[model samples]
Target: TRMRPLMRGGAQERGRRAGTENVPGIAGFGAAALEARSNLEARTAHFLQLRSRLEDGLDEIENVKIIAREAPRAPHISSFIVKGVRAESLALNLDLKGFAVGTGSACASGALEPSHVLGAMGYSASEAKSALRVSFGVQNTEAEVDEFLAALREMTNRNGTLSGRSTSHFTL
Candidate 1:
């Protein structure tokens, strides 16, 4: 005779997951996924536009260089290097000013290791260490970009003098 459905079920196979189901969390996840799917295209376009403006603002700053400027990059990600300042220091200063930024890859933060991505793309250790990453979200605006750039310029100038190194001048 065939086994009963409940009896045939493995001990580890309680519904879809091995552990107890989280009904509320699962429902929330489904709702979030649906909303994300609905807004995906429009959100992506907005991010791309913000990223473009951010890049333009950064490019106009003296002594700042963008990594992989010529390469195909994600529309929402902007990575750059400010001449003569450490990435960690820049990130910290930016944080104090209420703008959150990252140094190199998010995974490599606090590791004191240079970015492997920059290394693979032929950036020197110093160049990679000077890198900053700004990921644009749908909520960012042109005014925010301008404010960030102003803060970045002031911080870079201060750090450059303190470090006693010439500002990085990169052309691609």
Candidate 2:
């Protein structure tokens, strides 16, 4: 019987395994870390501003609650529950309208179960299942955030429960 290394290259692991050093990956990671460190304050302020805008807009919508509103959280991400709509339904509708959104933890991606994090926070199973996560990035602009808020407001208002099928009429 013969066994092959999972990753084959010139030499790796003191010649015990075969793989090449991930030079490019290491370099890219270092570069990203340097960039993030260089403008940490400015980036943080920008993210906070965007998140504030998103939260304010969300506050205007009925039946939507921002999770952990009083808790300190990362500035770039906002998690919320939009009652009467499943997270999957809203995420899929947003995707079809050219917007990318997340439902729960990436590890739980595509799982029909509710978010354990939200459940731990005392949210009901239905509330946890209705959670949506939106993250702001350095490349995102104020206009983009406004657009997303508008789209979300419209979808939630017009689609109601959106339990059966999505009828997203949002554009751009």
Q: RMSD, each candidate, Å?
A: 7.3, 4.0
Every candidate's lDDT: 0.73, 0.78
Per-candidate TM vs. native?
0.76, 0.81
Q: For residues 101-166, what per-residue lDDT tens digits would candidate 1 score against the true structure?
A: 878765566567898878888888888898888987677787888888787777665435323233
Evaluated at residue 104, the lDDT of candidate 1 is 74
Candidate 1 stretches with Cα past 4 Å from truth are: 1-20, 158-172
- lDDT winner: 2
lDDT of 2 at 109: 56
List clashing residue pairs in candidate 1: none
